[model samples]
Target: MLDNFPFYLGLLIIILLLIMLANKIKVAYPVLLVLAGLAISFFPGVPVIKIDPELIFFIFLPPLLYEAAWTVSWKQMWRWRRIITSFAFIVVFVSAFSVAIVANYFIPGFSLALGFVLGAIVSPPDAVSAGAILKFVKVPKTLSSILEGESLLNDASSLIIFRFAMIAVATEQFIFYKAAISFSWMVFGGVAIGLLIGWLFMKAHKYLPTDANLDIFLSLLTPYIIYLAAEEVHSSGVLAVVSCGLLLSNNRHRFLSSKSRLQSLNVWESLCFILNGLVFMLIGLDLPEITKGLEETSLMTAIGYGVLITFVLIISRIISSYGAVIVTLIARNFITVADNRNPGYKTPFILGWTGMRGVVSLAAALSIPVYLNNGNGFPQRNLILFITFIVILLTLLIQGLTLPYFIKKIKLNDIYDPVPRHEAANHLKQELAEFVLDYLKTNYEGQTEHNPSLQHLIQKWEQHIKGIDNEIISQDHKHIYLDLIIQQRKWLINKNKEDQTLDESIIRRQMHYLDIEEEKLRYI
Candidate 1:
């Protein structure tokens, strides 16, 4: 390998450029990045960049999962939990099992266990990949929520299957009863440990004399600590991180200050952005190495197998998605369900079509032990890598590219909201605003009369309540506020330029607050 610093620096620059191009052309960044990486690998003197399996599992997986678990709307997740869990756990199992059956039956000289290894590697869709692509497509809120919720759990479940399959491969034995017990322990125990850790961290944040940066730093540390502890106990580290994130996310306001919460969002955003970029580019960079690993299988033959497996995964997921919807329809009658109305077929179709393989699959393929306990080479390791790469390539190119068109074609109905969300949101805003205004007017009449700021706030809310439904008026009002914000920003920039005496920290703090105000406007 070349000097690590320059290689990564160059790769980072390429990723940024490719992302810009992706945005300009309305293509997913991962698609362009993959192609860019593939093209770069062929250039003379370019080093083949191989991501360490441990690095992906340890360094990359935890925080991304934690952040997603935390930031996603908990209400939405719970609303779709049944659908999500089925896709996350049951669908993955069925896909992996289906893949195993197909691989063992069709591929020559492969054991049931080896087939399962390949199955597990490719079973779960990559959350990162799905998310990146989903950004470009307009999906129903219900569809998006279900996909997001599934991603949080599927990673853990698929990896668990991977673990069991690997053990079966290594020992040439798998006892279902023992494996079931182990699986239960891994799931139940990991979640318990995560909840316990989250409680401890919650207490620490509440009691410790930690400032905003320290709070953000502790948040960063939480995921890594939870992941390591669970993995050390041979439990599901992925599940542990996820559970811990959920617990902390829901309870953060109880422990962290407002300033800490705001700052941590920016920190996590930037960190996750860099990580997503590097992983997408790195997925492309590993092409040369993966191709070189093939010995017994021809490139075309392995690709054929990959294409076959990709088809299997697609068909299985589609079938299982529909199955989940059907099962949910039946189950809701007997048990309480989040939404009992028929979800219709289009959303399920979208859910099924979006299972693109990504960097995680590549890493899982690479993570397969180089040699078994018997000291012989792992069966078809290079072939597995090739097939994984092919599956990733096909799915990214196929589903990732075609998703937007399909979404437009399908035009799935928005089941979550009967009324337009914009209308509902504004209606809710009016109620909340009116509630606050009444409280202030009732309790702080003297302050409202005496304080100019309080009087202005009351007047503004009164005006807003009157104009909230009038889009043209509200738009103009928003623009006025935004334009003034811009003037203040420009003045600050000029002031900073003109003077060297003011502390940069204070200037930056003001700038951050302005950003929050702007974001709040856009969100509303």
Candidate 2:
């Protein structure tokens, strides 16, 4: 494999080309990458790609989860906490059991435990796939938030189930109480460790001597450190990375320099794309190997099983989604819910239809130990891998292709936020401008008399408040501008917490601009 570095490099070149082609053709790149890899795998002399489970779990999963945590709004996550948790924990558990029952009954020699192993591998919808497809279709903010938030945590829950199932299969026993206790510890313990580490890192960033480069390096190191710490204690590493990432993200302004924050974002964005792209391409490339590994079941039979289970996943998720709606409607009767009225079925159905599987399933399917603890080969390992591949390929194609249609046909009017996104953004800016103007006038009215830059900032805010061009400048007057930015940020932060209607993301965007402005004022 080391000697084949050039070949691997060439393959990546081809993968990037195919991705570009996918964009031009208006098809999702994951689908095309799979198709391209499949075609490449069949070519003479092309090595059958093998996935290293450790590589996927450690190298890939943590950073991806961390980036997602940074992007997702904490406020939104809290608002839709019930729905997100149900989908992440409840729906994943149900979906896994649904597959387990179906596989155990239908697949020859497949035990319920082994069935659960397969179920856990494939149950959680891949974050990469959902994010890719969501952009293609316009959906309600709440629905997208639910899906994104679910994807972040579902991986952790599914992996937990996968671990337990592997243990059950190895030991030929299932201890319900012990497993339940372990699950609790993993979830809560992971979060606790994450918060602890997050606080430490936050303080380090604030007090430690660090520039943009060092900050970016620490940002990269953060998820891996948190993940390793949590997993070392037999807790959920995925949750740890997520929780820590969210903590850092929320408090970024407190610590990270504006340049560091922006640079870190760009670096993570590129890294995520490369990692996800490589796996998607590898999915296509690994098919021939996964296909050839099957000895217990015929390729056609395995594919048939894959198709059957894929449908099962779809149906179960749809039912669970509707079930969630029903439960939400009922629970709202006794408890406080955002909307008590019978929340209709369209949104729930859309959520249900979006249960596509991807890279994690591929990695988990391959992660199955080739030989069990007793030395005999793992049963139906090839079949599992093949089915997982089929599920990924089929889901990416079927759901990915059809999601736009479903969204279009459903005619979803699920408007959780009455304020349009653009309008909300504009309103936020107006309020900020007004506040800044007041703050400047109140604190430094006479101080700006000799300072042209500060005066310019004040005048710009006044014109911006009047709906004129809002271009504002602040080059010199470093101390004055910095102080003013700090004051405005404090007000904006307080204002955001006070008004629930204003989108947190809009606040973040404004916060981001302030970061840039402050960075310039301080350094340049």
Most lDDT-accurate candidate: 2
lDDT of 1 by residue, 257-338 (tens): 6568788988999999888888878888899999999888888898899999999999999999999999888988899987
- Taking all chains together, each candidate's TM-score versus the true structure is 0.88, 0.96
- Give me candidate 1's TM-score against the actual structure: 0.88
Cα lDDT of model 2 by residue, 434-467, tens digit: 8878888888878788877777878878898888
Report how far residue 159 has shifted in candidate 2, in Å: 1.0
Name every residue pair that clashes in candidate 2.
Answer: none
> In candidate 1, what residue range of length 10 has the lowest lDDT sum?
468-477
Angstrom error of the Cα, residue 156, model 2: value is 0.9
Model 1 spans > 4 angstroms off:
1-4, 446-454, 468-524
| Leading candidate by TM-score | 2
Task: Please give the lDDT score at residue 73 for candidate 1.
Answer: 53
Query: What value does the lDDT take at residue 264 in candidate 1?
Result: 91
